[model samples]
Target: MAANNGLRYKDKVTIVTGGSKGIGLGVVQVFVKNGAKVVFCARREAEGKEVEADLNKLGIGEALFIPCDVSKEEEIKNLIEKTVAKYGRIDCLVNNAGYHPPHMPIDDFSSDDFRELLNVNLVSYFIAAKYALPYLRKVEGNIINMSSLVGQIGQFGAVTYVATKGGISAMTRALSIDEAKYNVRVNSVSPGNVWTPMWNSGAQATPNPEKTIENGANSQLIGRYGTLEESGTACLFLAADATFCTGIDLNLSGGAELNYGIKTMRGEKELPF
Candidate 1:
C-alpha cells in the first residue's frame, strides 16, 4: 500500500487516553491531522479542555476531551460509553495513559505501591481494551498499547514501572491471538527516551538537568531525544498502515538497543573508512 495521505483517516473515530499532554497529545494531534475524530481523556479537566480547543482550531478533524482518571473502573467504563454514545462507533483505541514515579529501589516500594502503579499503567489498558473490543470487533479496528523499551530490557531502580510495561506487552500479544477471530488487531509501541513533559520534569528534578538531558540524548544512537511528532507518526503508521502487524511490540528506540558499547559523539571523530 502507499503511505497514508493527510486525510487517510477521514471520519474514522479514535479514542486516546492521557491525551491532554505528552505522547498522548502527540497521538491525538496526528490522528486529528489525518482526519480522525478523536475523543481523548485526561485527569486534568483544564488541560484536557485546552487541548480540545487547540486541536479543534485546526479544522481538519474533530476532538473531544473528557476528564477521566483511568485508575477508576467506573471512569473508564463511562469514558467508553460516552465515546460510543457520541460517535456511534469506534475504529481504534490507544491505551496510552500511564504513571511513572521517581526512580526508587525495590526495597523502597511496598507491594501496595506496586499494585497501585499497575492499576494506572497496566490494568487500565486491559479495562479499556475489554470495553472497546465489542465496538472494535464490529469495525475490525485495532488497539495500540504504549509500552517502554525498559519493559524489554531492564532499568535499575524502576522495578515497578518495568513490571507494568512488560505485562502490557505480554497482554497485548495474548489479546491479539484471541481477538484475531474477531478481526480485532492488538499491538504495542515500545518507546525509548521520548522527549515529553515527563522527561523534562524528570530531568529538571536532577542536580544537573542540562547534563542529564544531554546524557539521555547521547544514549541513543541517533544522538537526540525522539520528538512528539515522531512518536505520533509511529502510532499513526501502526494504526493505519501496518495492516499485517499484530501482537508485535514495535521498538521506537532510535537504535538504542542495537549494540553494547560506548556511543560516539557526532562530528567528534573521522569515520574508519
Candidate 2:
C-alpha cells in the first residue's frame, strides 16, 4: 500500500486530548492523515466543532470531536467511553490536553490558582491515561504525554507551571516501568519554543508583543520558532514507529535546551527565524 494509502496507522484508533487547536490539533492531523481513526476533545465546543468539520473532510480516516473538560473526571471518562464505543479499540493515547496559566510570582499565587494549574496541566494527563489504560493494554498500545522544556529546566516566574511539567516528565518514566509487564510503552514529548496559540497569547500579554515574539525566536539556537507540524510529527513517531522506545522524553525543541558555555555562545545575534 502507498504510504498515504492507509498504511501507517490504517484503521488504528487513537485519542488526542485538547485537539481543537495548537499542538494537539497538529497531532490529530498527523494521525488522521496517516489513516488512524482519531477521537479528539476540546473544552470549547465551538472550536471543537470547527476542527471536527475540517478533519471529517479527510477521506482516509475519521476524526471525532467530543467537547470535553479533561480537568473533570466525569468528562474524561466520557471521552474515553465514547471513543471506545465508536472505534471498539484504542491503539494510541496522546495526553496532549493541558493549560499554562500566566506567570505568577511565588508569593502572589492564591490557593485556588495553584490547584487549578495542577489540575489542568498535570492531573488531566493522569486521569486520561488511567481511563485509557485498560483499552491500551488490550492492544499493547503506547501513551505520549506532552511535556515542555520548562519542565526539565525550570522557568522563572512560572513556578507552578514548571512544577507540573517536571511532574509530567517524571511520570512518563515511572509509568513506562509500571506498564512494561503489559507490553505498553509510555513516553513524553518535551517541546521547546513552538509558535502556537499559547506562545502567541503570551506575546499578546507582553507590553511589546512584536518585540517579545522576536526575543522568543532569537532565544532558540535555531533562530526561529518550531512549527506545530514538527511537534505533531514527533508525537506520531512516538506512537507509531518507536516500538522499542519507552520511558524516554523526546525533546522536540531545535536544540533550545542545550547548554553552551559563554565562549561558545553566538558572538552576535542574527535575525530570528
Candidate 3:
C-alpha cells in the first residue's frame, strides 16, 4: 500500500519519542527504511549519540538525535522545534516512551511510582501532541501511541503500569475524534510480551528468570515473545499505511490477549516445589 503521497512515505518527516532504544528505536529504524526522515529523542545522551551514528552510517535516511525527557513540556516543545527547523514539517508522531517497574500490588505501590509512570507513559504524550499537533495539522499527519496488553486485561500485580497504558488507549481514542476534523489520525499499538530491554531486565531479575519467562512464553499462541521488528512493523502500519484508520487499538500481542486469566494453578506439578 502507498504510505503518504504515493503509498509509501518517501519524504515524510516523523518524530519518535524514546528513540534511543527498544521498541521506539525499532520504529525509528522502520521509518528510516521506508524513506521517512526520522527525528528521535531520549534522555540518555550516550545511547542517543550511538543510535544517531548507527543510522547515519546506513545512509538510507537522515536521523537526528535530540536529548530529551518526554515528560517535560519545554523539552517536548524544543524537540518539535528542532525537527521542524530541519525537516520543515512533521508527518507523524510516535509516542513510544514508557516506564515499567517491577511488579507490585496496588496496596504496596508508592505515590512516587504512580507519578513516575504518569510522567513517562501518559502525560508525555499529551505534552508531545500539544507541540506536534500544529505541524501535523499542516500535513494531516498521524499519531501512534504505544500501549500494552496488560492495560486491556489487567495484570495481577502491575497496577500502575497497566493504569497508565489504559489511559493511553483512552487518550488515543479521544484524541482521534478531536483531531479528525483537521484530517489528523490518532491510534495505538498494544504490545503484549515483547523481548526488548525492558523485558530483558525483568527476566534477569525474576526468580528462576529463564523458567519464568519460558512459562510466560508458552502462554502465548505463538509460543514465543515478540521482537522489536514486530512492534516496529505495527507502528509503521499505523503511521503510514492506515490512512483511513484512527482511534483504533492494534494488538501486537501474538494472540496472547485472547488467552486471558489462565495462570498456573497452585499445587500443580509445574510448580517449582
Give the per-residue lDDT of model 3 (tens digit) for 1-273: 343444256778999999988999899888887778899999999999998899878867678899999878899899999999998999999999898878755888999979988998999999999899999998999999999988898776678988999999999999999999999999999988888888878777776887878976875788898888888889988886788899999999888877455565566543331
For model 1, name the residue pairs that clash. Answer: none
| Per-model CA lDDT versus the true structure | 0.91, 0.87, 0.87
Against the true structure, what is every candidate's RMSD?
5.6, 4.0, 2.9
User: How displaced is residue 212 in candidate 2, in Å?
Assistant: 0.9
Writing each residue's lDDT as its tens digit, candidate 2 over 158-185 gives: 8888989999999999999999999999
Would you estimate the TM-scores of all the predictions? Answer: 0.93, 0.93, 0.92
| Cα displacement (Å) at residue 33, model 1 | 0.5
Off by over 4 Å in 2: 1-6, 261-273
Candidate number with greatest TM-score: 1
Error of 2 at 49 (Å): 1.3
Evaluated against the true structure, the overall lDDT of model 3 is 0.87
List the lowest-lDDT window of 10 residues for candidate 3: 264-273
- TM-score of structure candidate 1: 0.93
**What is the per-residue lDDT of model 1 for residues 1-273, given as tens digits with 9 covering 90 to 100?**
535455878888999999999999999999999999999999999999999999999988899999999999999999999999999999999999997877767889999999999999999999999999999999999999999999998775689999999999999999999999988899999998999999999888777789888988977899999988898899999998899999999999998887886544467442111
